[model samples]
Target: MTTEMSGADILIQALNDQGVEVVFGYPGGAVLPIYDALFNQQRIKHILVRQEGGAAHAAEGYARSTGKPGVVLVTSGPGATNAITGIADAMMDSIPMVVITGQVGTPLIGSDAFQECDTVGITRHVTKHNYLVKDPAKLGDIIHEAFHIATSGRPGPVVIDLPKDVQVATAPYRRTNTSALPHRGYKPAIKGDLTAIEQAIELLSKAERPMIYTGGGIINSGPAASMVLRELVKLTGAPVTSTLMGLGALPASSPQWLGMLGMHGTYEANMAMNQCDVMLCLGARFDDRVTGRLDAFSPHSKKIHVDIDRGSINKIVRVDVPIIGDVGRVLEDMVKLWKAREYQPRDLKPWWNTIKTWRDRNCLAYPASVESGEIVPQHAIRKLWEATHRQQPIITTEVGQHQMWAAQHFDFESPNKWLTSGGLGTMGYGLPAAIGAQLGNPKALVIDIAGEASIQMNIQEMGTATQYRLPVKVFILNNEYMGMVRQWQDLTYGGRYSSSYSDSLPDFVRLAEAYGWKGIRIERPDQLEQGIADMLAHDGPVMVDCMVAKMANCFPMIPSGASHTDMILDPAQVSGVMDDEAKALV
Candidate 1:
């Protein structure tokens, strides 16, 4: 049986068939028909964002937190363009998202039509795939293909540009159970290469000091591979470290876990990577943030790279054995091989002992100036982490020092747990994202670790959160400055703090109250735990103004234009001794 439906109805039906429960979007004239069709669809909850950018970011947050394909819809032209940044942000982070944009009628294609742009061409570079639906009959297939591309291997954003005429046109719609388009470029190796797995096993069986480096791909692939990788690390008795994107791939409290690695990585993790004999890189690209100076990174290690994308194999550092396959499948095969061969590295006691010594000596050192009457951002983050430890909570953050503090201090124990703008480093991402995340996981604890300046950028989202009664806790790091940039200026620009600080800042507590949400300010370290408890205990949305030190900088910083090797150990304690020690370790 076939049913006659408008293009918008077909699109919505297609999305519903694909299990899209929520969509973040802003309506316009071009998308009126689609919104009209959506009026009665109670199954799919539509979030009306204040801006198109917020819609995109909220979609991203939903995708990142729930490991589902985030859906965003916007009107044509400027509306579509506004979402470009957020789409690119998702692309860089490899988040699964489907962006739907309304277009001017197909007849008005290139006549400088009102609210029209070449959105398909504009978003080509940023999206994994895109479709300009000129024919209303093909709407369902296009949407199906869009979601398929978005959630497939190395997942990323996909755009479907719907012309106004197409949306209004009637078409015979069939909700097919399968996608119509074949993804030729996205060929993920589902089976493991037995030869490479054997080689990896042989290497691990003999290596004394070995380490496992992971990335976001592991999480994108789901928790099975991560579990296998963690088990492998435990069986081999090797230390494991993660990139910023890979933070939640392994339990942060695991004894084998060696904290995050890269520019701001702990000294122990960086030093261990440099000193290890065997490095097992699973689904992690050697990004500049992780590898600083390519020549200086893992100089003493024999690297083995396991990645689903063949392009990433030997893209940066040379690999001794390159296994191009799904990380989960590869690890399963390796585990079988290891069990069959009974492979175990011999006499690794001394190596592990040395690593433990290094881990103890060079633990992550943040400034603990509790009695100095200055609130430290790290302390606030730690308190938050303590309040929500391993509760399967969704933590989102904005850019700058607050982001770095969350990445450095928050103990993420599993994949699809921490959400942030990593590659794009986009500010004003937190509150909107947190709202989206709360919508995505209504029962889960969703918190936005936002900076005062960043939060104000999209502060209107507080109203949206309150309207939905989304219990999202927004912890505003109230430093009254752009903390990270200010730190750079203070260190390198001879303390020339320009536009970083402003005496005139909005009262966030009052702003929350104005938005019909509960708000509180925590000025002292002693009040942090109780404040967080009270905030968490609140039934609806709440905001905590965490007043932090203005000049506080993220530690283990790799100065801009400087190599990763040229990192500051302690921003406050820039003593020559720590600098010399850092240099010597490298």
Candidate 2:
């Protein structure tokens, strides 16, 4: 039986059919009808964010932590524009998300009428796929299709521009049992070529020095992929290193783990990549940060790249064998084929010895307490990990030195427990993402390990946490500088500090009080442990500001345009200011 309802109601019904429990958004004139429809329903709860940008980031946090597509709703014009940053962030990191933006009536779309703008046109590049709904009858189908595209095959944000007229128009809507609207041309490959899997196994078996480079694709493939990844590591006995976005895909406690590999990666991980004979790249693209100088990156290796997106394979660094299929599926096939042959794990004693020598450098070691009693950022991150790691907290971070420090120091034992702005490196992503993560995992510990400068980007989101009574914590490593920018200025611009100094910072304790959150400020090194305890003991949201060293710079860094081997291990290793050519590289 076909039931007649307004497009707004049909949208709500479609969302219900898709089993959407929560939506992060802000309501406005264009979305009034949709909001009205939302108000009438009890099944879907809408979280009202202070800004449209927060909504998108919160959705990102929710999606990344939950392994489900995050949903967003906002009005037209500025509302849609505000969400572009989060959408771009999700697209770059391959997060599954669906955003519905309310547009002006169909006739007003191109007229610049009131709040109307080119929503579809503006979001086309950021989204995996997008749709502009002119017909009310097609609304449900489009909604279903949007979710399908957003969640499947290299997951990313998808936008649906809904006009006011379409929202008000009546249509015959039929409830469908299936959540996805099938598209014949959009089927993504799931299984890998058997021959290629066999070839990968053969190369891995013969190699004396082997490295397994994994990334976010394994995390996106769910817990099963991580399990298979562990099994594969056991069979191959190869050292494993992951990208920034790929943290937590494998247990850090594992002996085969080599930590993250990139510009700011560990010494052992980077050295392993540089010296490997056979490099098995799984679900990780060789981005500039990871590859350093492309020509010098893993030059001695026979690379085998496995990725679901064919576009990602050989995009930056060409591989000897390219297996285009789902990472988890391909890994399963490889595991079965290898076990069927009863292949013994390779002898890697010499390789392990070399890696251990690199590890002896203690690249991550930092002063626990300075002569001035100021906190070291690296030490603070390590202490923070020690305090909360037992609880298995979900940690999110804003971009900068604090972010890299957290990535290096904080160990993740399971997947989905660590979320951060990896690709876009958005400054204000952590606070709102923490909010989203907390809401999605109500009982679990959720913390935003933020920097003083970056935390202020969406500090207003503290109010959202207070309103919901969420116990999300914000641990701010206060150094009074946009740390990464300052570091870059030192290296690229000869220590001439520019606008990176955050002199006009707010009193975070008072700011937290104003937002109805518990606040704590730890200035001395002795106060760090107790302050963390109090924040964790709080029943509601708490924000902690831990003052740290000001002039600290992250190490084991491959300077821009330099190879993995050309790393600056410490401040003394920095010879002079870099040239314009090196400064141009990120």
Candidate 3:
């Protein structure tokens, strides 16, 4: 004997049981029953997004910032299809999310009825797991399990396809025990092997040139991991460099930090990566962007990799010691072992001196001042950082040259504050991500550093901001082109910028005003500071169209198939077109 409840009601109760307070979603015919259930209850709040894609990105931002699994709901057919990008984005970046999509009634699922689709079939590759529920009794357990799987080992998005009839059906609602999820085979390694940890420590202790290469894994492990990493860096006195996703793991202002390492990475960081005798990789897979040419990547170094996922270890670059466990715990073990042995690392002053010489190149150097009426994008980013760093703002970015510039200029002091699309390089991630970030951290300043072309991908989300009264800022670096595409075209295709030019652009200020938000336009160098000041002063959503130079390309670029040392630092060095083979490497 049990209390019977509608599948829709059970779904809501299950979400409540899992501690989900907010869901980003859009309603439609197939999901009417669920939406009606949502209307009757106040325990869970729903954010009505302009588009399904925006909902997914907003959930991603919320999850990335809060370290909680983001929730999403959308109707069947196009609604489910529209969220593909965001789901894939979560999969690539390893975000925790549970997306519930409505489907046609069970009888209609295979009959090609109106708005019918094979939701689970389509999302299988992009999700950690998926479910198509025909039975209402099993729905509650599946929902609970979805959340557990999403938030568990090497977190990622999970999809649940609920048919309209199933949602309307009645069933006995028994809340599942979240801690004792039925997926017993999915346990992830937490504590590392102590012997392997001791061996890694012993190797590092004798190394004359040791380097720490960490990535998003530490950030995903929670803030404590970052703290342990900082302590470990201090004890060993090793130079540090991070991938784009791993930026905030170590404070950018730390003396040992050499800045981000990769295609658009700092010269000093890349140089150190190339020259280090001992490399300790924590929670980072050696992505192509970071490794450059695999054959030439850190050839002489004895590598050590620590990661929670066994599959990620030695998947790309083989390491001498592979410690499979949570990055934070592995680091803690290493710290304890080093202290117990009283190990002291050899002098690395010579290595530091060599790194200093690379830093002296000032590869990021660009004209700080452009004459009135023109802005350099890099300078604009630096100025944005200058004004907002004191507040320790949460910064988000759309994928493009502006994203790289923000990574270069914005010094993140802690984990979970910087949000951007790293693995997927999805455009239009910034504005909506800022919306979620602002809502999650109501008192904190959340800004999206967007490129002109990329912002248009989801500019409609400003309406979502206005409706919610979120004071999220959109700072568009108006370069009048798809900056990265144009850069790649210039490098690999003989500067034939075919479709890269942004033509017929809308008046962003007017668009902002029409959306019931304040707008600012900065066309000159003199107005930069005050414009930013005015934007921050406004208590509502604001859009700043900061006009920047069109032809300025991002520098310190390692051409496809080039080694870490073979980077082009200036426009003058960009010459020659690559063949078809070279074009595919990047």
Task: Judging by TM-score, tell me the better candidate of 1 and 3.
Answer: 3
**TM-score list, all predictions:** 0.94, 0.99, 0.99
Q: Whose lDDT is higher: candidate 1's or candidate 3's?
A: 3
* lDDT (Cα, tens digit) per residue for candidate 3, span 390-417: 8989999999999998998889999999
Backbone clashes in model 3, listed as residue pairs: none
Q: What lDDT score is found at residue 417 in candidate 3?
A: 96
Candidate 3 — what's its lDDT?
Answer: 0.92
Give candidate 3 misplaced runs (Cα > 4 Å): none
Across 230-306, the per-residue lDDT of candidate 1 in tens digits comes to 87877788888898888888898898888888877876687788888999998888877788767677778889998
lDDT, residue 451, model 3? 93
The window of 10 residues in a row where model 2 has the poorest summed lDDT is 175-184
Candidate lDDT values, in order = 0.84, 0.92, 0.92
